[model samples]
Target: MAFAENIKKIFTLPDLRNRILITIGILILIRVFAHIPLPGVDLENLKEFFAKNQIFGLLNMFSGGAMQNFSIIMMGVGPYITASIVMTLLPHVIPQLDALSKEGEAGQRKINQYTRFLTVPLAAFQALAMIKLLSAGGISGQQIITGDFTGGNLIIALITITAGTMLLMWLGEIISENGIGNGVSLIITLGIVAGIPSQVRNTLAVITGEGGVDTGQLLSFVFFA
Candidate 1:
């Protein structure tokens, strides 16, 4: 079969089709949500924020463009990972948790619940830190929300961001249950896959442009071909 026929055969398998579609949707959501900035991040202030921060480079890789957008999801999964780390240390500090882990499936379930419960504050604090850091870097309070980082807006904003992360986390779970493959892993994979077509197109564009591939590259392409 030709390449298209192979693709058609893959999608014709119902499970594979659903998995592909689910993957596509999650990727779309990731792309779209990351662009939705929190009320407070000043797009104008980014140049200054990036000026002195090593974190921006790291955040860019993890958050894609979310941090640059100052999105509610700008914290990405950093807090979740942190919470997991803390949970790992819990057994060493707390005897009760250490005992609980001995309880098997039930214990593991409780641990997961604890991790999730901890994730809220973890996410909130992470969000706050990111906001303050970026703001101090040069973003105006006004840009964070147009006006007033009042007590209410701060809580609301925190809740909004926390909830957004939780929702993404939940969608990942649903995808795992209803869709094929591991949901969380697929969501992460989606980011890399999402960038592929465009990169390929860009490469092709360059290849077809004036001078295009040099003799060596063309020869290499043919050799590999």
Candidate 2:
């Protein structure tokens, strides 16, 4: 079969094989990071809250469940993506950036550097928002962060989350340089894919009435639909 031959040929080519392997290795590393939770999180309460809140459930799916886990990479490539989007739009509005954009690769590199710089504050801000939301504890009145989530712990969390975003950004660049395809997009795609199984299971539970679809909740769902 042509498909089979092509698959075989991919492995037979050393460069292609190495690139594929490198991509896989990086993806595995990202998944591992997704499971490594940050300190001070009450994961049980967090998980329960996510289970009850559809909005955060969707966010968790996009985050590869890192948000639910309160992982270091909980922000994933989100801040970087926001930064890239901002940078892309800025060149259109700012004359200086517009002129720089015409410098070709050099200009693009500068824009990318700016994007990376922007990601830091965005990551920290998002981390703060997440902490605030989780600490609020939803309808269950159960805080996702146990005890006082302030002072040194809060500072450490912000730095750790921001650093995690930077680490992912660096890894994505590495993949782009050494592996195949657009690394950041690949990471985001893989994250979405990784959450599919749990999403399906949750959907099934809802359909089977195991999700306890109350009258108000059902009405809200229908209204949204």
Candidate 3:
């Protein structure tokens, strides 16, 4: 069969079609979560800062633009990804971890559980760091965090962001179990792809505007490519 016909035949199989649909539905859920903001954020200030900061612009892309909105899952799968990486490397560095890793499914489950525990602290640390960075005069200047940062409110913010990371980790695991492809990879891919329209719009704006073209930015793009 031709490639297109093979694809059609694959989808015609009810099982494969259902799995694909479920995967798509789960991805949609992730996008929805990316828009649900955490409390007390000055979204307009955040957006303005993100527009001006290239580093933040890249962060927003990787985070499904969740960071731009200060969404609950603004940290994206970063903590989980970091934890997984650490665990993967630990097996090579620690003899005990190496031994456990060789014990099959139960051992892998234990490693995963440990990784999950590690993610909590990592998420909390990342959230606090992000909050401080955004509140500092140089990054956002406009006090995107709002209110005081030294009391119960600070704790609340940490907990909220950590919880969001855990929630995303759980959702990704579900996708791995019930859907198609590597769930975490698919999530990140969607986040990056989500910025396409805005990128095209900005490129067009730069091309058509009365202002002279930004040669530096053009050169940077060329070098990056």
Q: Pick the candidate with the highest TM-score.
A: 2
Per-model TM-score, in order, reads 0.72, 0.89, 0.84
Q: Per model, how many backbone clashes are there?
A: 4, 0, 0
Find the 10 residues in a row with the least total lDDT in model 1: 138-147
Kindly provide the TM-score of model 2 when superposed on the true structure, using C-alpha atoms: 0.89
Ranking by TM-score: 2, 3, 1
Pairs with steric clashes in candidate 2: none
Question: lDDT of all the models against the reference?
Answer: 0.65, 0.83, 0.79
Q: Which ranges of candidate 3 are over 4 A from the true structure?
A: 1-8, 138-142, 147-150, 199-225
- Per-residue lDDT over 1-225 for candidate 1, one digit per residue giving the tens place of the 0 to 100 score: 599999989998998898779866876777788789766545655633432233343344346556666666666666666787899899989999999989999998899789888989989888877655544443333333233455897788778889877876776777877777577676666544443333333334446877455443343334323
Which regions in candidate 1 have their CA more than 4 angstroms from the true location?
1-6, 138-147, 189-225
Model 3 global lDDT (CA atoms, 0 to 1): 0.79
